[model samples]
Structures are given as structure tokens and as C-alpha cells.
Target chain A: MSFTRPDGRGNEDKRPLHIIYERLDRVDGSARFGFGDTKALASVSGPIEVRLAAEQPSKATFDVTVRPLSSLPGTESKALATSLRGLLSPSLILSRNPRTLLQLVVQSLTPSPIESYPPSLAAACINASSLALLNAGSIPMTGVVCAAGVALFRSTTEEDIPALVLDPSESESREAVGCGCFAFLFRTEIAGSQPLPTNDTPGARLVWTNWHVKDGTSDDGELARAQALGLAGAETIWRAIKQSVPQMDNLPPPPLPSRSTAGELGIITQSDEVSDQDMNDAKIEI
Target chain B: MALQTQTGTSTDLNAQIFQRLHPRAYLERFIKEDIRPDGREATEWRDLSVHVGSISTANGSALVRLGDTTVICGVKAEIAEPDLERPKEGFLVPNIDLPALCGPRFKPGPPSEEAQVLSDRLASTITAAGVLPLSALCIHPERAVWVLYVDATCINYDGNVFDAALIAMVAALKNTTLPTATFNEETGRTMCSRKLRKPLPLECLPVSYTFGVFDGTTVLADPAAFEEPLLDTSISIVLDEGGALLSAGQLGIADKDTMSMCVSAAKERLETYGREIYAFLE
Candidate 1:
């Protein structure tokens, strides 16, 4: 007997995804991302003055604040914000603006049920923050980050394996035996050139993950398969994001660090010397 | 260069300067030697000690010390109305406090983000892992339920507070005993019998093991305060007595293989340290 999803979607199918850039005018970058009913609005303000205590000499301090709808920001929101900071930091090149602050605020547009696990809300927050960072254009980033939520549902038949569903709806999540949110970093440029279409590309680096099973042990291969499915879902979202933002292609490339400047800053090491030599060769060829 | 010139003569002074100025590089040098600055192996856990029923005022209390990190948890039971939707279920509210006395980094004020995050993680772990069944706390459906407020405070902060705070909370919960509560429907109140007490019906003892990834290669188990900030990626695994994975959380960038390695290591650690820490309760 085949396992059926509550919403009648295929096991691998995700809810409708929506991405809107520049949702707010005041912030440097802003975006609103939604997975069906679950939606999050993220705004980015960065390269701003750093608080005295949070200032880091070598890198920018990143701060994330998550506000839940119809309620004050609580421990749950703070936990989400902490995870968001860690998930989004890998794609951001914060070293470009040292001793400064980059702040990202995420507000949930829809209220999630109190008892349900919030994998969809988490995924939406991450995707919205990624898009907001891209829209800001101030913070240099190595790649675009995307996330997907996967839920494990028990099979109706006794002999069958649990069904893994992507982008689970609120009600679906409530019935899930286990769920996880996985975020991946997709590098847009390879050696200063845009790579081929990423649809067939493998190995998007895993940046963040949070998995929890309500009861009973999961099967050995269940988590690995869920992660793979999450990767596929995130890739689909990445493709959608790429298609929606034509201006992303026209954004100025990140500035290359010159050898002299790096040496003056006392950050250059033996490994950097090789890159410096390659830069000099390229300059001579030009 | 100026710092080196000032402390050139004394190697001790130079070492201190290196630790203060380039903490990450200093830690990397020690990590390359396959040893932490505190003389532990890459996967070595610090000394852990657990003591339960320490406080008499609270219904249940436990003190857990992992290395220099010390966390004390107290379980306070109170009578409250059950939510309308889940009339048969109780509430387990876990809050962690990192006061200014614990460390210099934490200030005395409202709950900081770190404290809130830890509290949230603990609450979710207890709920999702099914450590205790909420239905057991229901004295009368939709009328009154026993609410267990598991509050953990870090008296000394050395690092890996999540593990310490969780261990403390679980231990405290295990030591908790709720009074026999009876609802007086006429008075519309719940009365508790102080003499007759019953322990919480905990289904499983879910133990959590946290590992930090250094230089994206080496995994440090039970990272200390000094090591926590420098490491970017951390993986936490929660396992029950039967070695079943209850919950797992990872922050920052780490590959799947590393995560699996941490899980396997967590299982092995559960057999060794995890058992020893909870042995006192039995």
C-alpha cells in the first residue's frame, strides 16, 4: 500500500513558493518569502556602526532578531534568530567590513500553531534572510543560501516505510513523526564566471540543519534520505530565486584584495602569497 | 610587532599575549598537535559530576558540573488551568538563566539571547523527545494540570552550557515529586496533598552530547568556554537509553559525514559518560 500525504501532494512535492524582493523601503535590503500559508518577512541593515562591546576588529558582527506574529519575541524567536545567524553567516563575506554590524530582522507574517513544530516557518525565515541579503547589495556574499523543510510521516500500512514529505504544511507538520530543516549554500560564480545551470549540479554544501523525532527510533536511512530530499527542495527554491531576480546578475562583483593592502593589514600569510602571484600574472596579461 | 617587542624576553608573557591577541590561531596550533590547551584529546569530555535533591525548598533540584561549568536546576510544581485544545496535557516550561556572576560576558538584566535560546532548546528537547508524558500531569481534564517549571541557572560558565543545563534539567526532573492533586469542583479549585507525593512519569532518559567542529575537520567533544566561541559549527545529538536518536541539532557549516561521526561518538559516549552521570539516580 502506498503512503498518502494529508494534503494529497506527492511525497517529494513542496507547497507553492513565493519570493518578493524589496518588500520594505527603509531597510538596505528586504524580502518576503512564503511557503503556502507559512510566510516570513526579512529586512537587512548592515555595514552600520557596531556596538562597543560587539565590535570585532577583523570581521563584522552579525545579529539576527526574529519576531513572531501576534506575540512578543520570546525564547522561541530568539532560538530561531540564533540558528538563522549561524545558517546565513557562511554565505556572507563579513570580513570586508570590519568592526561594523550587520543586522537582519525576520518577522513572521503568519501565525503558526502553538503545538506544531515550525520547520516551515524556519525554512521561510532562512530563505527570506538570504534574499534580503542579496537585495541589500552592500554585504559581499560568496553564494545564495536556501533552505527546505522535510517531514517524516508514518506509513499507513504496517510493512511500509515512513513517507518523507518536502515543505510540509502546518497540519501535515502536526502529524509528522519527525521533521528537519536543512539549508544549503549555492555558489553562483565559479572562478569569476557564472557556472552552468545548477539543476544537475551536485554537492551544495550543507550550512545548517535541525532535526527532531517525536518518538520511536527512526530508520537508519530515513534522515539521510530526508536530507537529500531537502537538498533537492532547496535547489528548486534556489532556481526560483535566481529566475525572479534579474538584477542579481547585474550586481557588481566583489572587490579582490590586493597583496599590499593585505600585507599592510598583517593578514597575509604564505598561502595568500600564491594567490598574490596569480593576481600579478593576470594583471600583466591584461 | 609592538606586542612581541614588549614581551619578547618572557615566553610565558608571550604565550599569554598570543592567547589574548590571536585566540583562534593559538587554538589552531594546539589543535594541530591533536590536543586542546586544557590537555584533552579532540573528542575528550571534561569531568562531569551530578548531584540530585540538593535543594529542599523546590520540589526537585539537581546540580550538574561539567568541567568548570556549573548549572543548578530546580523543578517547581504549580497548579494551572489546562489549555482548551489540549485539556489532558500539562506544560513543561524550561527557562535557563545566565546571571552576571556566572561569567564576564553575561550581564545582569533580562534573559539574554543565549539564555533564551538554551531555554528554548531544553524545552523542545523535553517535549519532542517525550522525556515525560504530559498526560500524566493532568489531574482533571480541562480543570487543573500540574505545571512543572524547570528553571536552570548557570552559576559558573565555562562553556557547553546547553549540555550542562539540559543534564541539570533532566536530573532535576527525575528528582521531582508532585503532590497528589484533587480538583474540588464545587469550589472550582485544585487542592494538593503535601503528604502523598508521586514522581513524574518519565518515559525515557534522553541524554544529549554536543560536539564542536574546529577548522572544519576536527571534532571537539564537550567544548569548553574558550573553545565554544572560536568554533563555528556545533552538533548536538540526543539519544535515549536504547541508543535511539531522539533529536539532533546542528548550527553552522558541517558535512553529513561529520554529523554521522558525531552521532556515533554520541552513542559511544552515552555508553560511557552518559551512564556514569545518571548512575547516581538509580
Candidate 2:
């Protein structure tokens, strides 16, 4: 008997993909992407004058904002922003545009039910934000980046045979003893002068990796297997994004907001408690 | 940071020697004598100074200085509607601000990750401390309640802002005197007494002690700012005046000795917090 995943897909199968590009007109870039029930929207704006306090003299600043579908934004959102900033900052050549602020806003339109697979939401967010940044075109990039989530789950039929499931849902992640989120970037396309290490290896350069293993389960040989499996999953995602481009529609010009720019800020739509003062750089330090 | 830990000598020209000896060697030598770099014993703490009722404009305020680290706390009490879910319970909002004046790493914009973490920790700590019971804060149950917005600002950043913030907040809360509220039966509204005469009821005080571990085992209590980033592991333990462990934050897997040493250090310093606050109020 064969073991099937919660979503009824094969161990190596990806969820049905849906990516909407440049959803907004005026913003430099915007994208809405989903992997099954989990969905997120991302928008990129600027290379513009940053607020007085956050301005840097030699390099551009990255202001990453993440919004959830419900409840107040707290440490979790801040953590997401921090993680996303760390992941994306490396892929971007920020020195090109000095003394400017690039705002990256991500909104989780639907919450994934799989609590154990928290990285899946981040994977989707990372892909959506990267897609939006690409669409915006204003922000300089060194390489094309995409991320995928993978986990090891026990089969219902044999219990002992754990399957390495790609694009694991929250339910599948909870059942899996080990899980990982991996991101990749095409090396030849990015930066200058650092030649691809070798001809066979020019395939995919690892950009980011975050892995986890459930407690009580020892790490005998599963970590290496998870890493290889995650890298393969990331390669698959990178291929899909590359192939989808030829079939994708050309991005239309961004539309301008009818009202004042401040009224349309990402901050206003974030949470109920935030006021106009919050939009005008009210200190988060407090 | 790497230079301070070298024990074996002299080949590297850039290596920093502590008193002509390696830093790790200095630490090991001091440990035998039970002393530390700053001239204090392993369990000894730096000097602490507290000044209450310093900000006249605020309902209550205090400034706390723990060694070189400084924090000023202000409490503003105002009447506000109670939450629908828990109409009888009042609200308490504690925010910790880190301005540029505090350090070079922090900017003047929205709260950084450190500030947010500190703010959330202090808020929960204050609630857990049970310093102001919700029932007493309610002027009229389900109608209006006194909301205390406690804000702590770090003016100088040396080390251990969390402990200093909580201490300043405690001092400020003790110094606070609320105006007596009377229910006007005719108007069916609560009226505030012109003179601030009533004091909020006290519950329990929670004090936190932070320690840093070198390599992975040696526990150094009350680490200075420069020593924090270099630590392999660190732990902060919070205990109430009753000696119950309320909460703790730790990085990396801590050793058994580290936990025991931190708890004993916390217990030893618990009384000093109360004694100093009592002396200040008097």
C-alpha cells in the first residue's frame, strides 16, 4: 500500500501555484501569491528619501513590514520582519542606491492552519516579496531568489518509513519529526566577477537555510538528509518561477491612489490600534 | 571580544593582554581569589541609586541608575472605559523607549527589536508583579477605570536595561499618589477629588537578576554592556518579594550550576530592592 500526504499529493509534489503580479498601479511592485489555503500579498516601494533617523550615508535602508490577517501585531510580526530583512538584504545590492529607504510590506491574507509548519508561511512570504521586488524593478537585485518548505513525515501504512514531503502543509509539518525552509538564487545572474564555482554546480546557489528537528528525536543522520532534500525542493521552486515568467502577463503601469499618499500607506491597513502618528515614524523603540 | 579570551601567550602581535597576562588567564586567576575584572566579587553587584518623585509634571516618576546604566520612568494616570470582555479589570501599558542617547546601535525612529522585547517583558513583569490590582484601579466597574501608562526611557545604555527599567518603574509606582474618585450618584458619573490624596494598593514586587556565562559554564552575575555580546550563554531570572520564581530568559542550553547560582544571586539581592524603595518613600 502507498502512503499519501494530507493534501493527497505525492511526497515531492508542490501545491497548486497562483501568483498575481503588480496588483497595485503606483507602487514600484506588488504581488499576491498562494500555496493552497495559505496566501500572502507583498508590495515594494522606493529608493526614496528615508526618515531622518533611519537614514544611512553609504547604503540604502530596508524597512520590512509584515501584517497578519487578524489580531494585533506583536513580537511575532517583528520577528518575521527581522527574518525577512535578513534573508532579502543579502540578495540585494543596496549600495547602488545610497541614502534611500526601500520599504517591503507583506500581508498574510489567510492564515495557514498548520501550526507546526510555521516556516511555510514565511516561505510563501519570502517568495511573494521577492516577486514583488522583481516587479517593482526600482530595487536593484543581484540574483533571482525563491524559497520552499520541506518536512519528514511518517507514512500511515508503514509508520517506520518517513517520507520527505516537499511543500508540506501545517498538518503534515506537525506529523513530521524534522522540517526545513530553504531558499536559492541563480549564481551566474548575480553580482560581478565571482565566477560560478564549477560548470555542474552553477545550477543553484544557496541563499538561506532554516531547519528544525523535534525534541526527543535524535539527529543521527536526518539533518544532512533534510538539507539535501530542502535544497532539491528549492531547486524545483526556482525552476517553476523561471518557467512561469514566459507565460506571465506583462506588468501594467502602477495606478496612483486617488487620495493623499499618507491615507494609502501600508501602516493604515496593518492594525486597528495604529494612528497617523504611527505612520509618521512614531518610535517603535518605546 | 576574541582577544579577551586568549590564555596561551605571545605570537600574535594584536593579542590584548590583561595586566601583561592573557584575559582568560586573568579571569581564571581572579576566580581562584573570587574576584572579577571590575574589582567586584563574583556574586557582588555594582552600586544602585534611585531617586523618586523627580518629574513634577508626571503623576509619579523616578530615575534609577545601576552602575553606569540609567533609566527614568514616568506614570500617567487617566480615566478610561473598561474593556467589554473584562469590564471590572483596568488596563496597564508599559513601554520601554531606547533613544539614540542610550546607545549608537539604536536609532530615533519606531522602537527597535530590543525596545519592543524590553517593553513586552516589562509589561508582563508589571502585570505579574501584581503591584496594582485591577479592582482597585476601577473607579466605577464596567463604566470607567484608571489606566496607568507607564513609560520608561533609557538615557544611558551600559548593560541590563530590563532590571533597571523594572526598578525605576517600581520606584515610580510607589511614588505615585492618585486623586480620590467619588461616584456622583446624582449625575451617575465618577468625579475625581481635587487633591491627589489616595494611593494605589500594593501587591508584590518582582525583582530580576541577570547573569552571563563564559564559554558555557562559568556564571558571571551582573555582566556589564561590553561583556554581554561576548557571552556564550546568558540568563535573567525574575523572582517576586515572596521568593517565588516568576519568570526567566535564557540563551543557549544552560548548565545546572548556572541556574542554581543565578537563583541564589537573585534571592540575595531581593531584600535590597525593598529596603531601598522603602527608604526612598520615607
Candidate 3:
């Protein structure tokens, strides 16, 4: 049994990713990242005077705030901010500036449905924050953190098997039995020196993962498989980030290729070893 | 001091000092004994109580107590214009306030991040569970409708404000009575008859259960203020009256088995605690 995606993309296909660096003025650094329709604008202002109560002697105080598109920032935004702070903290060397503050603000650019989880928004926020941090160039970072979202769906006929879809759209998410966001850190400076883990690679170090499952009967192995798919999707996003870093200095950031040409542009490449059909299998059967 | 000197035991420490220094370790010692510092079992919940219609001024009101935690919820109804898209539907706005008087951690100011998050969670949960039918609140289409402002105030913050606030909000809504209303076409206003009133129509009752995981195991039900911060992960499950899951959320890392365990435990709670709550309201 096979499941068809609402956006007509394959099970492993991701939405067209768009990134615009330094989109705002007056801020130290800013970036607008979009996963198809879902978008997030993130800005970084760091190493500033720390608040008296939040000051730390050994490391800088890292703060993250998230604002929703239309409504006042609420628990959803606060939860997102906390997740972002935890995911991005490992990549930053906060010890460089002691007793200072590094503040990052993320603003949502799309109307989120009240019912389903916002995995795409989370992925976009993490990616935009990473870009903003890199664009600022003031804070030392261990690596660039890239993220991807994957959702699991099971047909009524084949209740035992659930298919994993990468970068699910809003409508698709409404039908998801479970969904997760996965992030991986990649050191850009030493890209080719070592055989850097690509989409098909098995050993990409995970930075952070969040999973929300609706059905309690779902298998645990499905979560691991969804994460593996997210890792591959994140690698695709990392390649796009690598392409955009070199073009940051130029005015009018380069426009990303459309979804059709993404594969040809090497932004979304599929490995020959693992095919989409193989991933659709219900069980590993090992 | 004299007792310590006489005992001459280096490991001996004051109870308060031990709790203040290594809070996690202090809690872990209790968990190892299969009990909490407050003398509750691992899966045991705090005592819960509910009261309704205490505030005569508001349309409806309820006060709920879960152990030392306390929350009071009041519902106010006002006539307002409806949205263009949904002319027949009214509005249900729910907000939770955690003031400085509740606990020392909160300062007197605008709503803190925690409070805002709690309010948002409450609002979303109520909406997602379809607890009330908005169209039922409409006195007339498009021109005038009853806008319900459901406000929950925390009088004391021991922990698990989510569960207490939600219970209070649901009970208050259930207790609400709306006066008979008439929309006059010529006057362009809605008038209410104070004598004739009807109960707000509630579709279902949704109850939430929150659990905190200690040391990657030992799920603690309804953790107190002292146990909340030290736990690594917290999971919340919302179930309707029919034992159907409305929503499930996890803050930190937890495996699939843990999540399933929490859900099953929540269902069991819904059977016993949920019935007790409804029975009190009746």
C-alpha cells in the first residue's frame, strides 16, 4: 500500500527551500527562510550588555524569543524559543564573551493552523537562526545547524504500516499520525577534507530532535526511520546553505531554483543506493 | 548544632539544606523509595476539589484546588459583532493569569512567558477538543453575538497550573447561564432579559493529565512546584469524556514506550479522577 502526498511530492522529497540573508537593516544580522509556504524571519543581535539578573561570569547569556504572525506571542512561540535555544546552544561558543548577552528573535511569516503541529515552522526557525548567526560573524560557532521536518501517515487499510513524508505541507500535517523535526550540525570549513556525511551517510551527529505522536500504538522503529529521513532532508538543506554562504556579500541574495530544477542544480540530490520504494517498506525485516 | 556535633556523622545534613543544595538528588532519594517527598506514590495524584458559581457578578465562575495549587475561573458574556466569514459563530476567548501573589518566582508586571504559554495552551486545548459549540452562543447572525471572555486566575502556584486552570475553565463554562437576548433591527442593538436564562451548551468534557519523568524513568503524576523544575521531561495528555485522545504533547526527550505509558495512565485517570470531578459538579 502506498500513500500519496497532498503536494504531489514523493515520500522523501522536500519542499523548495528559500533563504534570504541580511533582509533587514539596523539589526546585526537577519535572514528570511521559507519552506515552501511556511516562512520565518530571524534576526541576531549579540554580545550586548547583559541584564543584571541574567549575567553569567563564564559564558554569555543566550536568549531566544519567537513572535507569531498575527497574534501575540503565546505558549507555542515560547516553546519554540526554548527548543531553538537548546538546539543552537551547542553550535555556539558562548564562552568567548563572558557576562554578555546574545539575543535572537524569530518572527513567523505564515498563518499556522490551530489543529496540527508546526514542524515546518520549527525547522524554518532553526535554519533562519543558524543563517543569522553565521551572517553576523561575531559569535564563534562550532558548525552550522540545519533542520528538516518529517511526518508519518498510515492508511486505514494498512494500519500496521506508516509512510514517512519529508517537509509535509499544512494539509498533509493535518492527517499525520506522528511528526518530528530533526537537526544536524555540519562544519562548513572542513567540507571536503573528510568525506563529510551526505544525505545517504549513516553517521551524521544529531544535534536535536522533537517528536509528537498522536497514536500510542505506533511502532518505535518508525520514529527512528522518520529521523533517518529527516537527517537526509537536513543534508539537502545544508547544501543549499553552503551555496548561499559564498554569495552573502553580493547585493540582492541569489534566488533559489524552483522545485523542478532543484535536483539539476544539485541542491536536492538523491543517493543511488537507497531508493524511495525501499523506504516505503513497513518493516525493516532484518 | 549541638546535636550535629554529638552525632559526628559527616553525611548528616539538615533537611532544608539538603533539599536546597542537591534538589534532584534529594528528589531521587524519594523516588528510589517509590514515594515523593510529599508522601505520594509515584503514579499518585494530589487531592483535587472543585466549586462553582461563587462569583455572583460574573455570568459563571468556578474555583478548583489541586493540593496547594488553586485557580479561579470566571466567564463574562458581552454582545459583539461576529466575524464576516463565520456569521453564525460567536467567540470563546480564554486567558490564564499567574500573578506575583501566586508565587515568589513571578514578579508584578505584564504576563510572564510562563503565564502566556499557559493561556495559549488552554485556549488551544479548548478549541481543539471542541468543548463548546460557538454557534450556540449567537443571539443573532452577523450583527450581534455573545463573546465569552473566560479568564482563569491562579491564586496559588504549587505546580500543574495547566490541569487546575483547565478544570476550572471547563467547570465555569458549564456553570455559565446566558440571559435571553433579542436583536432589534431598527435600534441596531441586542437587548437581554435578566429573568429568562439558559445554560451554555457544552459539547464534551476534555480533561488533561500531566506527568513528569524522573531520571528517564518513574513517571510522577501531577508533580508539585518543588518537583517540576528538576525533572528532565514533561508530558501532557488531553482526553475527552469518551476516553478519546484530543492532544498529546512532550516537552523534552521521551521514548515511544514512555509516551504510550503516559497515555494509558491518563486514560485510567480519566476513569477515576475524571468521574470524581464530574460527580462533584453534579
Order the candidates by lDDT, highest first — what do you get? 1, 3, 2
lDDT of 1 by residue, A1-286 (tens): 2778767888887777766564354789887788877888899998899999999999999999988877687678878888888888889999999999999999888886553338988999999999899889899998888999998887655776777899988777777888889999887445545557534543578888888887757355666778899999998888667654653332432332344433222221213345447535533542
- Higher-scoring candidate on DockQ, 2 or 3: 3
Instruction: Tell me the DockQ of each model, to 2 decimals.
Output: 0.51, 0.04, 0.13
Q: What is the two-chain DockQ of model 1? A: 0.51
* TM-scores of all predicted structures: 0.88, 0.51, 0.76
Instruction: Tell me how much of the true interface, by contacts, candidate 1 captures.
Output: 0.78
Backbone clash numbers for all candidates listed: 0, 12, 1
DockQ-based class of model 2: incorrect
lDDT of 3 by residue, B1-282 (tens): 554354357566777887887687779879988889999999999999999999999999999999999999999999899989899999999999999999998999999878877887788778756788899988889899999999999999999999999999999999999999999999998889979999988887777899988887789999999999987677787777777666666665455467668878988898776867855665
Candidate 3, after superposition: displacement of residue A280 in Å?
41
Which segments of candidate 1 are over 4 A away from where they belong?
A: A51-54, A114-117, A188-194, A198-202, A247-286, B1-14
- lDDT by residue for model 3 over A1-286, one digit each (tens)? 3888876889998777877664355778877687887888889998899999999999999999988878677577786787688678768999999999999999888888543237878888899999999888889998888888888887888666778899988777667876767777665555466664433332345655665555434243565677679888988787787766755654333554454454443332212224323423311421
Error of 2 at B182 (Å): 2.6
- How far off is residue A34 in model 1, in Å? 1.7
Model 2 lDDT per residue over B80-136, tens place: 889897788877778889999898778888888978867765775565446678788
Clash list (residue pairs), candidate 1: none
- Candidate 2 local lDDT, A4-28, one digit each (tens): 7766788777776655563475678
Worst 10 residues of 2 chain A by lDDT: A264-273
The per-residue C-alpha lDDT of model 1 at residue B30 equals 95
